[model samples]
Target: MTKLMIVEDDEKIRDELRLFFERYGYVVACATQFDHVVDEVLSAKPDILLLDINLPYYDGFYICRSIRKQSKMGIIIVTSRNAEMDELMSMNLGADDFVTKPFNTQILLARVASLAGRVRQDGVQTSVLNYGNFSLDANKMLLICGERSCELSKNEYRIAACLLRERGKIVTREQLMDDLWNNHQFLDDNTLTVNVNRLRRKMSEIHAEPSIQTKRGVGYRL
Candidate 1:
């Protein structure tokens, strides 16, 4: 079972998340106390952390930076602050994922499971997927080709995995969005394009930049 720590300040939302994750068989813990949260979290040693930006005592960014420095535990920012700066700051501070408030818990659960499932308690590589000349280590979120390698963000990893899964086939935009951004309901095309382009740049580091080819009006192919 994956141990998850909830750091929300909202009593109702915190309880809601606790009940929801518990029903799914997760070992859930909530940071009910605002003070000394860092020490408590370090001691509890949960596998994943659901952090909120508007925390008492200290904010989520501070907690995220503090925890990341001491532990490699997965950190997902669950906050009401949906600004682009907030998201960028969260990622910059070493958060593994970010989800704004008013989000569907189901989608949040999926994201948690997807990230935590990659590495076990022992921190070993869980799986490596190979397609043509390149290999993607899902556990490490790394794309490799020949002697070069590049680390991928969660979304980029998903995009790469989907593309490589359908190597020769053209994966339509809708299909990619469904598999990659199902949580977003309908992700903007420009956002998807931005992500795809970013993935391409990362893949380029491994000399596999051309592996992901755009399909004019369709979607993408690997």
Candidate 2:
């Protein structure tokens, strides 16, 4: 069974979460020591973390950053902070997913399952999708060519994979957004653009060629 850690301060809500996940066959654990959350998480070594932003000693953002520096465990922010900035900040800080409070548990479960399926031990995925010299290893979220390599974030990886797969073929914005949404990314048009731009920058950083090209009023292609 997957081990799930809940880093929420509210006892009532925390209990509710534990019960819900327990019903779904997860080995759930709660962080009682708010001040030592980082150490507790490191010790427990849960497969996934349900984090709340408003914490006692250290907030979710701090704990997220701290844990990310040490582990690759998936993190999903489950908090009442609904601002776009909060979601963006959480992702920027290495959270794999973000869900606001009053969330549908079923949807949250789906996200957790999806992330769980992607994560594995180090060097687990050896397969790579290639285009001439450039290649993408979905497992590591890495884009590589020769000796140069650049790590990709979740959204950036999705966008790059799509474009790389359809390298010479044009992909519309609607198509890209729909694929990301289907994958539990929940990205908007503007957000897709931002992700694409970031992907381009990462590709440039490694000097991987056959850059993703804009299709004027249509869409984008490699």
The clash numbers for all candidates, in the given order, read 0, 0
Query: What's the distance in Å from true for residue 2, model 2?
Result: 0.8
Question: What would the C-alpha RMSD of candidate 1 be, to one decimal place?
Answer: 12.9
Candidate 2 differs from the real structure by a C-alpha RMSD in angstroms, to one decimal, of: 13.7
Best by TM-score: 1
Q: What is the C-alpha RMSD of each candidate to the true structure, in Å?
A: 12.9, 13.7
Look at candidate 2 and tell me the lDDT of residue 19. Answer: 92
lDDT by residue for model 2 (102-193), tens = 98876676677556555542324223555534778776889987789989999998888777556567999988998899999989888988
- Displacement of residue 86 (Cα, Å) in model 2 is 0.6
- The global C-alpha lDDT for each of the candidates, from Candidate 1 onward, is 0.81, 0.82
Error of 2 at 46 (Å): 0.5
Q: For every model shown, what is its TM-score relative to the native structure? A: 0.57, 0.56
Runs of candidate 1 exceeding 4 Å displacement? 119-222
Where does model 2 exceed 4 Å of error?
A: 121-222
Q: What is the alpha-carbon lDDT of model 1 when measured against the actual structure?
A: 0.81
